[model samples]
Target: MLWLAFHFRALSLEVFSRGAAAPAPLVVVEKQGSRTWVIACNDAAEACGVHVGMAASAAQALADGLVVRRRDPSAERESLAGLAVWAGRFTPSVSLAPPDGLLLEISTCLSLHRGLGKLLKQARSGVTEMGYAATMACAPSSHGAWLLAKAEIEKAIREPARLGSLLAALPVALLDQPPAVVEGLERVGARTLGECLRLPRAGVARRFGQALIDELDRALGRVPETRAFFEPPASFERALELPAPVQAAEALLFAARRLLPELEGFLSLRQAGVQELELACRHERRDPTIVKLGFVKPTRDAGRMQLLLRETLGRTRLPAPVHTIVLRAPLVLPLSASSGDLFQARNGEADGDLLLERLRIRLGKDAVHGIESAADHRPERAWRPCQEQNHAAAAANRHRPLWLLPQPLPCHDGRLQLKSGPERIESGWWDGGDVARDYYVAEDRNGAQLWVYCDRVSGEWFVHGVFA
Candidate 1:
């Protein structure tokens, strides 16, 4: 099993948000209840002889400045999910370690990311970018790295032998013992793992129960740690460096043209379509220009992507001549087979694969997009547009239309009659914004059919979707 060590990047700020007033200093106080308690206090809060975990009344008796909020279990969970998404850049096999930590299985990704040391730095960097600090450790087992990260375990990691020595220096606390077992061990003067290891194995197990011993075995690489792995999403990305700084859109797209084929090849191999892709064009003297492309569904076809890119690029201007270009496919999805004539049909469509390359040459890679379903289920959120080369499969889905109105428009009268449907779609409520919409297909007296919806609770009418 690939081991990962995770920590709460910052629990205090994330758990408790403060308003912009010169208020008292806030502190998180853990209590003996089923829930974790957060107490907001100041110098007066500190003077109450009250500390975190003290009884609420005790805290109030000490200082009147106490704002209490029950700990948000949901917030912690959401934080873990965000961490998992950020960690996806390192490895797809990311698991949530409750409270505030991520357990990523990076064994298979080590080689691809340059090695364990680089991978660790990369993981740390990924978390750091999200407005927090994090450290990562990798070992043969989860408990080993879990303890290492908690203890801020650092080693040169030049060789596996050095890693062993670092493990040996660890304290018994790193073993994650229960309160009673730890107290008993401390009473007996066993502070470090070395001391504990020197003791008789049978005696240690008998005294602490087999669980601690089993954990030790795993940490020492004796027993095995079994865990399920996550499958990486399918995606394709291409990058190119310009021969010379070129401000002309055509010149920039020329480099993109060459990179499209490789991206298509990667997508074809994965049997996936690009859901979304980002383009970064680096300038020698100015900030790199960034653009995004999206598709309606999963697609591997390159020609349609080319069309979209050409159209999008035609409207953009290069701020400066570019030196290098980068293409990133941050989202990808499974490719579905198209329902059509299986064999060579009477009319063969323009090879999407070839067209994407040519378009890259003309529009620059940053200008293309394919659309894919967003993870959310809201009518407006059900799909996300992505770069064409990346979400190739979604680009190939011919069912979706080309033009999209920013938001569905309200009908004349601001009140729409439910002509066809009360198709209620309810989704994404548990996580954050819950949607309950009663959908309908109505038409103006002029015979212009419109797709509309009304809020189930609010009874507010809105044009939600449309069919052309």
Candidate 2:
């Protein structure tokens, strides 16, 4: 079996720094009694000599304009769980690796992705797009891949025979052991895995206990490894709190873009598409300004969805400063495969759907509507306005005029030429209005086709519509 490990080095800092305007010198601090200490630092913070375990006050003094945030274990865990769900798109057997890592069992699905190299490239690119920098490694054993990823060794050791040689070269400190065991190993001149392995097994077991031996055995593939794979949640509701309040609605788009990829990944894993979603802009003092987005077709494409969202946001006027944005997809439908006709010319149905989606967002949903066939048989009441339309169903079985008048107009001139025979209409008795007429396709004096009908009871003609 092949195992892929992703190690997010500075998860806490990365999670908080996602939508920041500039890469500032930021550090995550933990409160210890009365003193606060640095737990994680970004690249800018590290460059200015801010290291983990350093006092927060000392670090701030060393670097000007340093940003310090308290470490949130819950946020870090939530981020890790979200990443695990995102990784489920690549493989079914995905497991969370604690504070900032993931393990994916991908051996069974390697051929489907062509090979390991392409799969790794896609996974790394996807992770980067989701606003996180990760180091990845692949190995025969799960723990071995985790160690390699932590060490930033981008190697794929699939062969069991090569696992020993490669893992032995890694430092003994990379093993998942107690601090005392690691210190004792270092004091005994066993600074690397190879040195520790060279010592007699019985003596090492007696000194380090059975747990250390089991850990080593697991990493080296001497025993079987089992993990509880992560399961994605049924519904998606992701919210991002901005670093600062956004006054303009358009300004929120930058933060919203970061959430789109995660949504896309979630939909991909579920093999579903969303028809409607709601974006709630949380205000500081007022109620949240909500923008409801409806799509003409169910879609999972992030780029198309973002384009529609930008158009909607461009026209929105914020009531107050927004501190947080929550995106929720309330309606998700199964996505079906579609294929185009090879023999005929391409139809612009997809393009038309996109245009309708954009128009619905730019204008109000009530303002933009589609024409659908109604149950009434009368020409004026035969169709109704709806949000979604089926063009194929509307065009079926009968020919109708391009334009219909609000009420039938009396035809005074008797010199009209008839092109088609009369079609009888005898319905509408169930309602209050009753109509019994013989409709005919007639041409007027100007050579325009007019839809005229003769009233069966009065024997009078009226023009109802015109053909384009």
Best by TM-score: 2
Name the weakest run of 10 consecutive residues (lDDT summed) in model 2: 337-346
TM-score of 1: 0.46
Evaluate residue 10 in candidate 2 and report its C-alpha lDDT on the 0 to 100 scale.
80
Q: Once superposed on the true structure, which residue ranges of model 1 sit more than 4 Å away at CA?
A: 12-29, 33-68, 156-160, 230-468
Q: Write the per-residue lDDT of candidate 1 for residues 79-170, one digit (tens) a residue.
A: 45545544655666767666666677767877987988787775555454333455567676666676677677643233345556677778
Report lDDT (CA) for all predictions. 0.60, 0.84
Per-residue accuracy of model 2 over 439-463 as CA lDDT, tens digit each: 9999888898888999998999999
After TM-score superposition, the amount by which residue 263's alpha carbon in candidate 2 deviates from its true location, in angstroms, is 2.3
Residue 427 in candidate 1 has what lDDT?
Answer: 88
Q: What is the TM-score of each candidate against the true structure?
A: 0.46, 0.87
Ten residues in a row with the worst lDDT in model 1?
Answer: 339-348
